[model samples]
Target: MKRGIFIVLEGPDRSGKSTQAALLKTWFEALGREVIVTREPGGTYLSEKIRKILLDPKSRIEPMTELFLYETSRIKHTLEKILPALKAGKVIISDRFTLSTTAYQGYGRGLPIKTVETLNRIATLGLKPHLTLVMDIPDKVFARRERAGEKLQGADRIEREPDSFRRRVNRAYKTLARRPGITRVNAGRPVAEIQREIRARVAKILKRQAWKRGNKKQ
Candidate 1:
């Protein structure tokens, strides 16, 4: 069977990655594709446990400690959930992936980018997403959304971080956008507009993959 498409939607908190993931899943299902929507650090039972520790505001985790936790969760998520889904030919729409770790732990926490990349390779076993949509939003928009109480009540540890940290993360995402297999989406528009743009890009990728497969069969 053909390996499934792996798409990751990554961005800062409240950037609508989850919303886009859901929309993408629905769109894929409508096309009669088997779709699985999962998130990093919480895809499997062990990963979910690690997610709680990583996201608890009361917990005090050192930078390197936090990094290892994320990678540990990732390996489990990759081995238990992602690889199997791909082998079975099911589309996977993940809310966040390795990019998040690079942005959050590497840039936001002031870790070495090269070290983070190496760890990411080890954790994911060198599996890369087919497409990664970096949902880009301006700092002002992000602050406004936070001030507007978008998710103030249930803010995760990362969300409760200082503005400086969030700014670093935002910049990291912008820098990461230049990498291969990444498409930066301007997420400051209306929800429907953003989804439309996402769908268009995804359609192109699907078409390209289909062409490649047809040629291989020929």
Candidate 2:
């Protein structure tokens, strides 16, 4: 049986990633595909504990230390939750993945990108998302969302940072989207419209992959 596709949705905090991920999960399930919806930094029990430390507002963590903690959680999550589901031929949709680490810590926190890449490789065991959906939005919108109380209670550490810091993170996301195999979505659009666009894009990719698999079998 063909292994399942790994789809990751990445963006700055409050960019509607969770909503889009849920929409995609439902869309895939509606098509009769087995889908496993999970989130990084907290997918598994051990990872969830790590997540608390990583996101806690009061935690005084250095940039490098924060990076390793995030990677640690990812390693646990990948081994315990993501890999097994993918091996069983179930589509895995993640709210955030390695790209978040590259953007948030590498660019936002000014950590070395090379180090971040190495850690990500080890954490994910070289697994990569078949498609990465990057939700792009302006800093103004993100700040407004945070002020409006849409931010996650504990995960607002990044959001509460200075505006310039958030801009750097957003820029990193845009840059990553320009890389091969990453799709950029205008997250400033209405949530419904964004979901529709994501669903269409995902459907197209799945169909193409299915055709490729069929041809290989022939």
Candidate 3:
């Protein structure tokens, strides 16, 4: 069977990654493709348990412990969900991936980058997304999200972090965007506009992959 592409939408809190992922899923379904939409730290039953702990503001988790929990959840998610779907040739749209760990734990929580990368490798077993869309929003838009009560009533533990921590996380995402397989999208614009750009980028990848498969078959 032909392998499917893995695409990830990653960004800081209130950056609309989940919304964009949902839009992508719908768009891909309209094109008659087999697609699977999953989110990290919560893909499997056990992983969701870890997710609840991670997102509980009342819980005090040490930086390394938090990082370990994330990796553990990812291990279960990858083994139980991601790898199987990919093997079945389903286009996987992940809300976040290993990059989130590096950004949130390594950069946001001041953990060692090398150590985090090592753990991530172990958890993912070297699997990686074919493309990653990193959303970038302006401070004004973030403030608006807060003012609209999106941040006030719906924030997870990480979402409730201070401005300094969010700033660091944002910086890490920006830096990650410079790396290969990562595309930065300015999400401060209207949702439709951003979605259009995302579709365009993904279309190119699908086209290229189609071409490659044709050549192989020929």
Candidate 4:
């Protein structure tokens, strides 16, 4: 059987990654495809445990330490969950993946890009998303969202970073968006508008994948 499609939604905190992941899951379900929706750094049991430490505001995790924690979580999440689902031919809609590390650690934390990329490769075992949707939002919007009440109760360690850190992460995202296999979606617009755009782009990729599979079946 053909492996499943992997779609990763990436963005900084409060950037609508969760909302989009949900919408994408719904869209894939409506199409009658088997789908497994998961999130990075917390997909598996051990990964969730790692996530707690990584996100706890009181935790004083060094940048390198944070990087290793993320990698370990990815290794577990990918091996136990993501890989098996793909092997079963189930579509995977993930909230974040290795790209997150690249943007957050490499760019946001100012770690060496080469080192970050190397670690990501090790964690993922060279697996990559077929398509990545980057939700791009401005700092002004982020500031407003951060100020809004009720987002903090569940806020984690990463969200507690300063505005300067957020800007750096956003910059990393912008740079990565220009690379291959990545699409940038303006998230400052209406949520519906953003979802519509995402659906349209994803549709194209699905169609292309379908064509490839059809050829293989011939």
Candidate 5:
């Protein structure tokens, strides 16, 4: 059987990664594909438990400790959920993934980029996403959203971080967007417009995958 595509929606907080992920899943299903919508740091049972600790506002976790916890959650999520889904030819639309770690911990927290990359490779066993949609929003738009109280309800530890940290993370995402296999989407636009751009990109990926499979059989 042909291996399935892995698409990740990665961005800073409240950038509509979750919303786009859901829309992507629906679009894939409409194409008669098996779609699995999941999130990082909380895919499997144990991972979900770890997620609570990682996101709890009261948890005072050191930078290295936080990094390890995320990687731990990722390894479990990969082995128990992601790999199997892909093996079964199911498209996996994840809310966040390794790029998130690189952005948040490496850039946002001022951790060593090389160290973060090493841990990421170890955790995911070098598994890479076929497509990563990096949702990009301007600082002014982010501020507007905050003022509108969009994600203020029971904010997580990361969400509640100070302005400086958020600025670092926002910049981190823009930097990461330069990497190959990642598409940066202007998330400040209307939701439908953003989804249309995402769908166009996803269609190209799916088409390419189908072409490759056909070539392999010939």
Candidate 6:
């Protein structure tokens, strides 16, 4: 069986990556494709536990320590969920992946980009997403959305950071998207418009893949 495409949606918090991921999964499924929707730091049981530790506001972990924990979660998620699904020819729509680590830790936390990239490679085991759709929104829009949500009993350490940190994270995401195989989507638009843009992109990718397979068969 052909290996399935791995697509990731990445952005700062409240950028609607999760919503778009779900919508893309449904759209792909409607086209008779098997699609799996999953998220980083919480895709597997082990990862979910790590996610709790990482996200807890009370936790006072060091920067490197936090990065390692995220890598650990990603390694487990890749092995237990992503690899098997791809081998079975199912498209995997990941809400966040290695990019988050790079942005959050490498940029937001001021970690060296080279070190973060090395760790990310190990975490992913050389697997790269076939496509990455980055949702880009202004920092002001992100802040508005974040504040609109109910205040949690306690905010995570990352969430508690000043707006400057989040802005750096967003900049990192945009930089990453400039690399090959990543598509930057303007997420500042209306929800319906964003969804339509994503659908069109996915359709084009599917068509190209189908054409490639047909040629190989012929």
Q: Tell me the spans in candidate 2 whose CA falls farther than 4 Å from its real position.
A: 146-155
lDDT (C-alpha, whole model) for all candidates = 0.90, 0.87, 0.89, 0.87, 0.90, 0.87
> Per-residue lDDT tens digits of candidate 4, residues 10-120?
987778888877888888889888888898888999999999999888999999999999999999999999888988989998989999999999999989999999999
* lDDT score, candidate 5: 0.90
Model 1 spans with C-alpha error above 4 angstroms = 1-3, 146-154
Name the runs in model 3 displaced over 4 angstroms: 146-154
| Maximum-TM-score candidate | 5
Candidates in order, TM-scores: namely: 0.94, 0.92, 0.93, 0.93, 0.94, 0.93
Query: Which model is ahead, 1 or 3, in terms of lDDT?
Result: 1
Which pairs of residues have clashing backbones in candidate 6?
none
Could you give candidate 2's per-residue lDDT for residues 41-68 as a string of tens digits?
7899999998878767778899999999
Poorly placed runs, candidate 4 (over 4 Å): 1-3, 146-151
Cα RMSD (Å) between model 2 and the true structure?
A: 2.2
Which regions of candidate 5 fall more than 4 Å away from where they truly are? 146-152
- How far in Å is the alpha carbon of 107 misplaced in model 2? 0.5
TM-score of candidate 3 relative to the true fold: 0.93
Q: Write the number of the candidate with greater lDDT, choosing between 3 and 5.
A: 5
